[model samples]
Target chain A: MSAKMSAATYPLSGPAKVEINEVAPRDGLQIEPFIVPTEGKVAFVNALARCGFARIEATSFTSARAIPALADAEAVMHQVERVAGVGLTVLVPNLRGLERALSCRPDEVNLVMSSSETHNRANLRMTREQSQAQLLAMIAEAGKAGVPVNVSLSTVFGCPFEGDVSEAEVMRLAKAFADAGAAGITLCDTTGMAYPNQVAALCETFQRALPKTGLTIHLHNTRGMGLANAIAAWQTGVTRFDAAAGGLGGCPYAPGASGNVSTEELVHMFASMGVDTGVELGALLDVVAGVSDLVQRDVSSQLLRAGPRLRTHQPPAWMEEFFAKA
Target chain B: MSAKMSAATYPLSGPAKVEINEVAPRDGLQIEPFIVPTEGKVAFVNALARCGFARIEATSFTSARAIPALADAEAVMHQVERVAGVGLTVLVPNLRGLERALSCRPDEVNLVMSSSETHNRANLRMTREQSQAQLLAMIAEAGKAGVPVNVSLSTVFGCPFEGDVSEAEVMRLAKAFADAGAAGITLCDTTGMAYPNQVAALCETFQRALPKTGLTIHLHNTRGMGLANAIAAWQTGVTRFDAAAGGLGGCPYAPGASGNVSTEELVHMFASMGVDTGVELGALLDVVAGVSDLVQRDVSSQLLRAGPRLRTHQPPAWMEEFFAKA
Candidate 1:
């Protein structure tokens, strides 16, 4: 069969290149029980910076009392090696967090809220309206400082506390943020409840609603649908994604669920499909090795264990002998 | 924002229903370090039978010397409860295995061989030519006994030892078997080497080549592309899939690789997409739990850990109290 037939057979065509936004330092490290040392964190971010990622969410400027693991966010941001092409994005939860992040001159600032009121209150300790107002203000504040903002709207697919987050609600928030000067809007699958169809539908809607705004999909592999959702989103023309090294960072509320989609696995999938991720698989894997060592445990990355798809193995001795006889 | 736009946005459309073939008994148990008791194996098969799978590959009729884990295949087959609608398929390697499987009067007989010459020799201890002759003969013999045969073409995607088994070779072998009266063919990703584009391409090619023959895709999650490949195959209109409960069953040759595409996770994905899988997700999860208990360890099923997508959780106590104050 011709390659044309294969491409035609697939429903949605993907872009020539996808932009991977590395979120390990901020999202992955935020939920760890033990904090990674400031120096180790710096080294990790610096290693990721060299891997050709379009952006690395280096750290979150949230209160030290709230998230102790990223208490040294400022230190990590200041110390990490800044490559010319790779943008360093930092999470800013509020005006206070934005001020802290601004002092470091972040390349991009990420704001956070939730589509589900219950999840917003449970996660951010505020009502959805209150969180939206706060995030919108942060976006305007960051815009004044000439820093672009990407708002990560959590539970855009579904909420653990409340069953379904309506599509209209998600669209409303996304449009509101995009109109209010946010450069990007990331639809976050906070607890990994997003399915492939839901991802495609919402991605299609968000892309249509805010055609100029950069859209990113942040997914979790909690139900083993992370890569599937990623593929669906990509097919629907989403070019930006948020993934964590070693698949770190999970919601504490979703017991037994896995963390973010592994950066290596996602890049590997796109690369295997002949789609350019602009990230070197080998260099990215080497960085994951460091993440694993720093975590002091096996992280949930499949590629780390299985190797790449093209990695070859030696035939068993008996098989060789049998083949010789043949 | 309409549902029609969402459906239209998605590239290849999916069928309203899909068939799931449960392979935990034969594929999953065959590679386990410890053999489950015959009674336990019977109980496991019986549980899966109730979960609405179109077919259950109960056991292999291989020699006791070759696969000790499935040595009691006949005993288990005779004792297990056979639900009327569920077809019981047993793996038959050659004439001898086919004779043994025929005695049980199985609903279907599954024949297996590797597409790669080296994998064929290593796995079956015979050259590709020898395996083709043997399996074709078995298919003829099984047809004489009025038992349908499905040839499971191992390493159709890629071979761990040989690597990059040519698609032309896979197509040549599949066409050979289908021309020889095999009722069905299963493309096995022996090492989880199949990616989405490759799967869609091959599925489209195979369907066009043998439109009358039943086509099934068997996948492994070794590199975390299991569900993504499945979605691709479904989009290409190949409805039959082979999955294992708890994602049990892996290729011993691909060291450190995970097992088959998870049955529960696959079912959950299709169900979430508004496709009818016939199988009840809750019942399948229960069966997976039983499989885990029988194996005496955790199986790699994501749904078992995360629960179903709509399973709601109560907000944290502190959050609830805070909301109460609000």
Candidate 2:
């Protein structure tokens, strides 16, 4: 091996605390038709917390009629024992949802606004400008209530309804979110339509546009470009990323979309290349297996299926002998 | 967008020639049970030749009893017309096969040696050393007959029995092949167990060892790291690659060994990244579709399923009008 190959080790440097915001509880479970028991939800949250994730999206505070999946959000929240240093965040669509989230006493509140007008109207029955206004008010209210807030901009790439999204549009919306007292901005490719070039270009532009605010790119591997895009984003200097454990998460509204980028796969790729991702692969797989059993269906993650790359185990002598004899 | 965004342009470079050695007629059809008509094989070869492939593995000259799939090897040789400047190669496992390939007047002859003892013994009924000796003898014979020879070292990553193959062992075998007057060495990940790090490390080591010899990394996406490994190999300065159109080729003897790296997908990835991989995506997909129809199975090439990234179409006027109305 050359000196270069031996020197493959990335020191974890950016943040002492690697905040893995668990979206599976909200983003993953919300899409499944099977309503998991409140106990299951509580157990799942506890399990994620045990995996060293500091921030967990405990549940969404949306209307029961709107998202039936999160109907028992309040009850589930009440049952779970909160871990120290772990902040629970909940998605709040409007003032009513924000009020509900506040009642749960979440550490952080996430307010989302769709960049595309068509999606905003289809999703919330409100125009994009109206949704932004609602988000601004929610941010102001959350600030006064002493709750940290993060805003997720959905369909920042090409939207299903509007088709191609311009860089100018994404920047304008990102600027609006940053101005609304939001602690961070999460760029979401809701339909999994963003290409690697688009991702790199956008990340570079956003980093320059908002240098002080943390930028997290939440990717959907619906088109198998998630990891490629992630690499491109990383190349463009974006640090924070939102990845679902075992590749578990998708938009219910986006038809044919599969899963988010697998956390195991992501960490495996980075770690193999000597990049520090602050994730333990073996421990992560244990969590994936636990959740996969609860879900019943086979998960879409390949790393879970194939195990980590270059990972091997020595078989017992008898097993080796048997194969050798054959 | 700044100059940084300009770097995101697809096919990031001008048209650079990639040596596309079409393996369809040989490695592609050799594992099938059903007989693909001679006319069909000829047509496939003719189509692939026009698709800007610099090299084509036309057929194998092995015994019909061992591989019934390539029974029409001589017929394909006579029927298919080669493109000017496109080198045609054939696989020859033994001296008899070499004699048969020589009769076909192939531009180059490929001698394959499985690095795994168990596979070499089972497949060729010979030990690894014995197979290597036979391959060396065949190379000598081909040289005497004025035929250029390329050596493919299979099972270089891992073996079914050995589990893990060390870099030293792979290098030893690669050095032996180069010493035997082989034109180039193809380092194959026969089991699809190699990751990008391994690929980079191994390719760099091999290149350092044999600075004069051309190196080709043939990969399989059995575990979803094929493209990543290929990219890693390319970045490490190993330019030549072997990909099956629609990823059609694999060893029939190896279980769970999936398809080769898809030609369409590889071409698309390179083109999208602004790297010049001379093979045209549309033409390659056409070959993939032809092979898919001939084989009667859905091949697992993602590019063929999901059209190239940034694929666009004109919207209907009525739809636009309706959207304006809405």
Most accurate candidate by TM-score:
1
Residue-level lDDT tens digits of model 2 in B256-299: 56778777767776666665666777877777777767876766
Candidate 1: residue pairs that collide: A11-B11, A11-B12, A12-B11
Candidate 2 lands at a TM-score of: 0.82
Maximum-DockQ candidate: 1
Q: lDDT of each structure?
A: 0.87, 0.74
Model 2 superposed RMSD (Cα): 5.3
Model 1 chain B lowest lDDT segment of ten: B1-10
Q: What is the TM-score of chain B in candidate 2?
A: 0.91
**Per-residue C-alpha lDDT of model 1 across residues A104-176, encoded as one tens digit per residue:** 9899999988899888887788998889889888888998899999999999988887888999999999989
Which regions of candidate 1 fall more than 4 Å away from where they truly are? A1-12, A254-256, B1-12
